[model samples]
Target: MDPGCHKLYHVHGFDSRQFLEHYLSDKADMVFGEESLKFPIENLTKVFTEGHIKGDVLIDLSLSSMVHHLYSACEFFNHIIVLKAQDRCILELKRWLNTRTGAFDWGHATKLHADIEGKCDQLQDKEEKVRSAVQHVMRCNLEQENMTDPIVLPPADCIISTWILGAISKDQDEYIRYLRKFSGLLKPGGHLIIIEDLDGTYYTVGNERHHYLTCDEDFLRKALVGEGFVINYCKVQKRTNMSDLVDYSSSIFIAAHREKSV
Candidate 1:
């Protein structure tokens, strides 16, 4: 398996199917149900089912929950493709998988596992920090993009991104440019799945602030349509969190190809 791909599995905690199931359910609740917003759970279920039947690639971008589901239900696809910004997320995932022997001392391994489990206990705890880490790394990647044309990693048949495009760049124009580059990474006719926090709000990690754009459903739908992606299904859900520091209103988008070109 590719090291990067393996790392994503490990960081997302795919040690067992039961764990993945619980994680997805909790994520669905936090982002959709709790905030009184609707999510495309059924659409996601359909995509997974189709991918399973056709043995196609599921390209997951930043959406750890869907990736977790796909990895747990291994029989659904030929292989998984994960696009992640942080090396630490990958490393943590690999540690969770325990793929390398002698990589960690027994005591250290025990502690690491406990830490991962504790973080996974709630969606907000895991998501806030993980996304912050991804954002920091993505900022680096965006800066690198200025020096050279963006590099397209291996392609996939179905692409899923959550909280990804809205966080592209601090500047709106730069964000659009970055997203266009991201769109170019997908193969023609491939699927695109997105979930984002709609309202402009802040999520804190140990007292640090991570700013977000006000990505309402209309703005995103219009943006994707303008980008030439057909709307297969779109749902705006309220994402609620128990924490006072975190924003509770968010939206989820699940879109597919409208034509054969990017």
Candidate 2:
């Protein structure tokens, strides 16, 4: 199985951000019986806007598909490190960073973000802000003891991995192990943001079908607590048939700080 084949929910290359906007962030279909429920990206914007933590040295443990959610984070962080297991993913991200002729379309995502933050007129400006914040795109292996070995790096103020552990982890045991390893990359009291696919065993990016480690909030919460994390905020977005193409049922987004109890 090609390990890098896993995608951001159902996105392979950039297209419409509709999957993100309507299904993930929209209230009509996304909210069940909660108090104005929002998706991970939307919640993340609120988190950043609340002025909680400025992840100055943010480490993106896995570069999933798009950096739409990290746009707000760029406004707070000085440096961003994006890591992917495959060379193609790294190169594709580099192509976008360097502004190559055919970079994947991220305009749709930026427009959505602008609407969320009420900054509609500054879409282009926000895009550049994200571009400038991302400083490194490195290759990494999630299986290794130290994912980014031989490349000495500073302890991250925050680490963000969206829908990656499920795609790469062999099973629940390995998922817990990976969580422990990721925690070491952060400083004490640092933040860890993880967005996962709930109750998803498979997702199709094209004609090919890729498998993921199916998990839910209970399992994930246990894993995080096992790794010495305190949950701050968690949002679960129930999937609507809006993106009926993808097999995922719900998207889980968690933001926890690593301020372990004594």
Candidate 3:
């Protein structure tokens, strides 16, 4: 969902159900396998129940809308892991979370070390440069397979990747590979929530044509189940403007516990 809808649905005094219904009706093309009208009710209900924020640690992959939702609804967690392809998103989240008034100080210490590596030419010291080069090479090699460089992190209780897997890769195999990588990040019995673009969206954003890997609820459910995750809850809805100038429809995924664990 877009930031506007996040504020609309989650903020005080707005009739969430009414807004969702109107939003869904306006973007019928994106609703998966059902009428747009029913989708709002179904999605809202699941968001209330399954998306209920409860966990010591939370990981948000997209680092935008999902992070906004998680932060707005819940305030406390032992640790929160946010994964993003772009450094700007990560930095923005860190800044936003820190400004919140409470014991929850989203400070730099709260940010777990990232998986990114720097280039050899960027480092002045020879020894440091060599190490950086090696790490950079290793990360590049992993990226080819849609895998993330492994990093030691605090134990997490919840994992959220919203509009990330689909938004990052257009290749189906690559998309699935990234999904598997995300699943591997979670501990046994940890919750995994994902929101993605359902329709094959090809929209323009700042002179770039952003493409999405078209996927349905069944495809995602099957993939997650095959990867040892049990479908606690799932929904495919037409979300409000996922982009700024590019108003395209999208879908959401909310799953939990990799079977027999949680």
Candidate 4:
């Protein structure tokens, strides 16, 4: 297939609801649950539990319209601001936040989170905490000087972006460009956490095929150092699920902090 024919996720847009059901749902036999649900939740829980990443404001730029990743952060952060490139993603999140009808069931994710922390009985409370911490969700454009232009966000203490760089960036240069924008949003010495599927070329959601920037651990390490971020933690889990919809060898989790001088 010609790269030119690929449907660019940043340009062609995405189906947020379908994306959730396909990748994050428990009932779906897609095998993405291990990577998309459990892997991130468990690793994020560990990173937060270690007490290394601490802050008041947390900005989330994760892939799709998911809140499972924030299950751990809400326990640590005072506020969470979700930034999305698509309005549908915002609407999907709003549906769940407002407790409206047709919201995607996140019970499985909540259960996974609670079980990992050995607080299975507090599942409902865990869900509510995430809702409470997420005070705002706004549209973002990575190309703009201010992603949330006209509304300059205060320098964040920590920012977490998962898989979005892969979905939006067409190449390494573009990925670094987005990374610079992400760094700009953070204050000096601020933390940045990223979870990405390494070496993936593309992924399918519903009937659309979205391009993924092919990258590996070495490239990411060099990129972060070049951007003046000191890597705090990095982990890679080999892909265990065999799926035809996406081609990724492994998933990478990185925790880093931007230098004050750079």
Question: In TM-score terms, which candidate is top?
Answer: 4
User: Which scores higher on TM-score, 1 or 3?
Assistant: 1
Query: lDDT tens string, model 1, 36-139?
Result: 21234344445555543233555555632233323212334455555555444445444434336532222322222224334334443333232322221121
Q: Give a tens-digit lDDT track for model 2, residues 12-126.
A: 4322233233223335454321211236558779777888768679988653445776888898899998977766667666777888887666675677778888999999899
What TM-score, computed on C-alpha atoms, does each candidate reach?
0.61, 0.83, 0.57, 0.97
Poorest 10 consecutive residues of model 4 by lDDT? 1-10
Ranking by TM-score: 4, 2, 1, 3
Which residue pairs in candidate 1 collide? 10-93, 11-93, 37-237, 37-238, 38-237
Worst 10 residues of 2 by lDDT: 14-23
Per-model lDDT = 0.46, 0.71, 0.45, 0.90
Would you list the clashing residue pairs of candidate 4?
none
Q: After the best TM-score superposition of candidate 1, give how far the Cα of residue 207 lies from its true spot, in angstroms.
A: 2.1
RMSD of each: 11.5, 5.5, 15.4, 1.1
Candidate 3, superposed: residue stretches over 4 Å from native: 1-53, 63-66, 72-76, 98-151, 239-250, 260-262
Per-residue lDDT over 1-262 for candidate 3, one digit per residue giving the tens place of the 0 to 100 score = 2222221111112222222223222344433223222332244334534445455655556522222234221333445555555433334434433443322221111111010112224222322222222111111122533444455544456666655576555466767777777776666777677666676544332333444566677778777877788777766556643334334455565666665431
Query: Could you tell me which residue pairs clash in candidate 3?
Result: 163-195
Ranking by lDDT: 4, 2, 1, 3
Could you tally the backbone clashes for each prediction?
A: 5, 0, 1, 0
